[model samples]
Structure formats: C-alpha cells, structure tokens
Target: MKSSIKDVVGEMVTPFLEENHMELVDVEYVKEGSNWFLRVYVDKEGGIDIEDCGRVSEFLSAQLDERDPIPSAYFLEVSSPGAERPLKKPRDYERAVGKHVLVTVYEPVDGLKEFEGTLTSYDETGLAVAIGQKTYRIPADKVASARLAIVF
Candidate 1:
C-alpha cells in the first residue's frame, strides 16, 4: 500500500518537476502515530528552497484533490532531502562521486553489509568507495540502499 502511494505520487509529480526544472528525489507515505503523512522530497542543481517546496506542495495538493487516489485523510509535505539525500538512481551515484556516502548491500561484501566512506567512482557495473586506506568495489546489483553521509 505504501509503495503504491509512492508510485502514484511519483507519477503525479514527474511532469510538474520537469516543467519547473526540478528533480524528484523520493515520495514516501508513512503513518506516524494516528496521522498519515505523504512526504515528497525534491531537489535541483543548487538545492531547493521554501518557495520551491511550496509550489510543489500546491500543485500536488490540487492534483491529489482531483484524483483522490488515497482514501484516507493525509497531510502533504514537500521539502528538500537535506545533506544526507538518498542516492536513488545511477545518475545520483555518478553525481555523488567524490562525496561521502553510506551504502548497504543486500548481502555482505567482504564480510560486511554496510560501508561508509568517500565515493571514489561509479559506472554502469558498480561503484568504488574508499574507507580510509581500504577501497571496496560494490556491484550495482548488490546495493540495497545508499545515501549521502555527514562525516562529522
């Protein structure tokens, strides 16, 4: 159900983001306590501001009102993904090269499931991350999740 909502929200926002020269980071439908929240994460080359988020929220709100894909009441939120933005696509990884990141694999790589360090490079096949003196080459298929990491 959560995945379905995310997909629907993604579909509904793609054209709006493109038209506005923005990029869709992620969409999440989650229940917190008794409230349901539909969160939309967006970004661009220079990052997003409050105005950008407001515009997206307004557009998505109207669309949701018209379609009413979700049956229950929910609050809509649009915001930047922040410094620890998730790397959700190949382009994201490629753009993340030279930045700090945390990657978790579906299975252990070198006896470990998670690696955190600087992203040295990324290509079609895999990515190389340098954790101090050691570097791990992780195949793209093995990655379960990846996101930017704050070194501090």
Candidate 2:
C-alpha cells in the first residue's frame, strides 16, 4: 500500500477539521462482506451533532471523489466517537485524567493485562489508574489500547 488509504484520508481531513475547530479521532477502512466502508471519527470540545457529521461527511466525500484514492467503491461515514471514545494520543490521555477508563496493555502489569478504574494521572512515565485504594503505573509503551469507561 502507498502509505495506506487511511493515512491519505487523514491527511485530507485534518485541515478541514482543524478549520472547523474539531479533532480527528480515527479513520477506518474496512470491507464488510461485499461492501467497503470508510468511517471517520471526529469530535469537538462540547461534542458534535448530526449537522457536524453531515458537514464532515460531505467534505470528506468530495475530497475522496476528487482524489479517488481507493480503487473500489466505499461508503463514507463521519460521526462522533461517543462516550467510550478511544485514547490514542497524548492529548486524549491528558483530557482523560480524573475520568474512568479501561486500559489494555501489551504485557501484564501487576499480574493483570487490563485495568478498569479512574485515571488519576498521565505523564511521560505512563498512567496512574486507581483501582479502589490501589494504583497501578502502566508504562506508556505497554499500552495496547485505551478508552473512556462508562460508569453505571
């Protein structure tokens, strides 16, 4: 692949999102049965609405149409990441401090591969997740995936 279709879309979408004061959460290109899908996740400070999604979808659709990066046809979808939004970047982790989160590590930390609790702190060292009175320091490089956890 030539830098990946997802990367291309990201490059194209970043400027548009930045101009609108929105952030790009993720971009996914996948095949579901006989159909292909290009999904774009975007968000803003106060959250986004359907109108925002529609605008992003339209903007991305036009850019993709002009670029024609993908050889096959694909449905384009733009939407929010919702309450369980992923924590992919440092800024995301920073914003997630004091919130409930679920983090899965590449290696076990304190005999556990996953941790679900309130994120007390996040820094260059990694993250400090408080599971009740206990806190685990997860190394930055050990994080496989992390997302906000919805409280019941």
Candidate 3:
C-alpha cells in the first residue's frame, strides 16, 4: 500500500521536478503513530530552500487533489534530503565521487558488508572507495544502500 503510494507520488512529481531543474531524491509514505505522512525529498545543484519545498508541496498537493491517488488522509511534506543524503540514483553516485560516503552491501565485498571512505570513482563496473591506504572495489549491484557521510 505504502509502496504504491510512493510510486504514484513519484510519477506525479518527476515531471514537475525536472521542469524546475530539481532532482527528486526520494518519496516515502509511512504511518507514524496514528497519522500517515507522505514525504518528498528534493535537491538541486547547490541545495534546496524552504521556498522550494513550499512550491513543491503546493504543486504536489494540487496534483494529488486532482488525481486522488491516495486512499486516506495524510500529511504531505516536501524538503531537502539534508547532509546525509541517500545516494539512490546513478547521478547521485556520480556526484558522490570524491566525497565521504557510507555504503552497505547485500554481501561482503572483500569480506566486509559495510564501507565508509572517500568514493574515489564510480563506473559501469563498480565503485572504488578508498579507506585510508586501501581501496575496495564494490559492485554496483551489490550496494544495498548508500549515503553521504559527515567526517566529524
């Protein structure tokens, strides 16, 4: 149910975001306590501001109203992904090169399931992450999750 909602919202928002030169980071539909919430995370070349969020919220709200895709009541939220942004797309991985990142894999690469280091390179083959003096080659398909990490 939640997954379908997320998918519907993603389809509705993609064109709007692309038209505005913004990137859709993620869409989440979840229940916290008694209330359901729909969250949309967006970003740009630099960063997203409150105004951008408001605009997205407004646009998405209108679209949702017109489509009525959701079945129940839910609060809609739109915002930036923040510092530790998830690396979900290929462009995200490309932008993450040379940045500090935390990555998790479905299986161990070099006997490790988790990796934290400077993402040196991202290619069709895989990723090259340098942790101290050693570099680990992680298959792209093996990545379960990835996010930008703060050094401090």
Residue-wise C-alpha lDDT for candidate 3, range 47-95, written one tens digit per residue: 9999999999999999999999998999999999999999988889999
* Per-residue C-alpha lDDT of model 2 across residues 1-152, encoded as one tens digit per residue: 52499899999999999999999999989889999989999999999999999999999998888989999888888999999999988999999999999999999999999999999999987999999999999999999999999989
Which has the greatest TM-score? 2
Q: What TM-score does model 3 achieve against the real structure?
A: 0.94
Instruction: State the displacement of the C-alpha of residue 124, model 2, in Å, after optimal TM-score superposition.
Output: 3.1
Answer with 2 or 3, whichever has the higher lDDT.
Answer: 2
For residues 1-152, could you state the per-residue lDDT of candidate 1 as single tens digits?
88998999999999999999999999989999999999999999898899999999999999999999999999999999999999998889989999999999999999989999999999988999999999999999999999999987
Model 3 RMSD to the real structure?
Answer: 1.2
* Candidate 3 positional error at 45, Å: 1.4
Name the weakest run of 10 consecutive residues (lDDT summed) in model 3.
121-130
Best by lDDT: 1
- Against the hidden reference, what TM-scores do the models get? 0.95, 0.96, 0.94
Q: How does residue 54 of candidate 2 score in lDDT?
A: 97
- Candidate 1 residue 17 Cα shift, in angstroms, is 0.8
User: What ranking emerges by TM-score with the best candidate at the front?
Assistant: 2, 1, 3
Score each candidate by Cα lDDT. Answer: 0.95, 0.94, 0.94
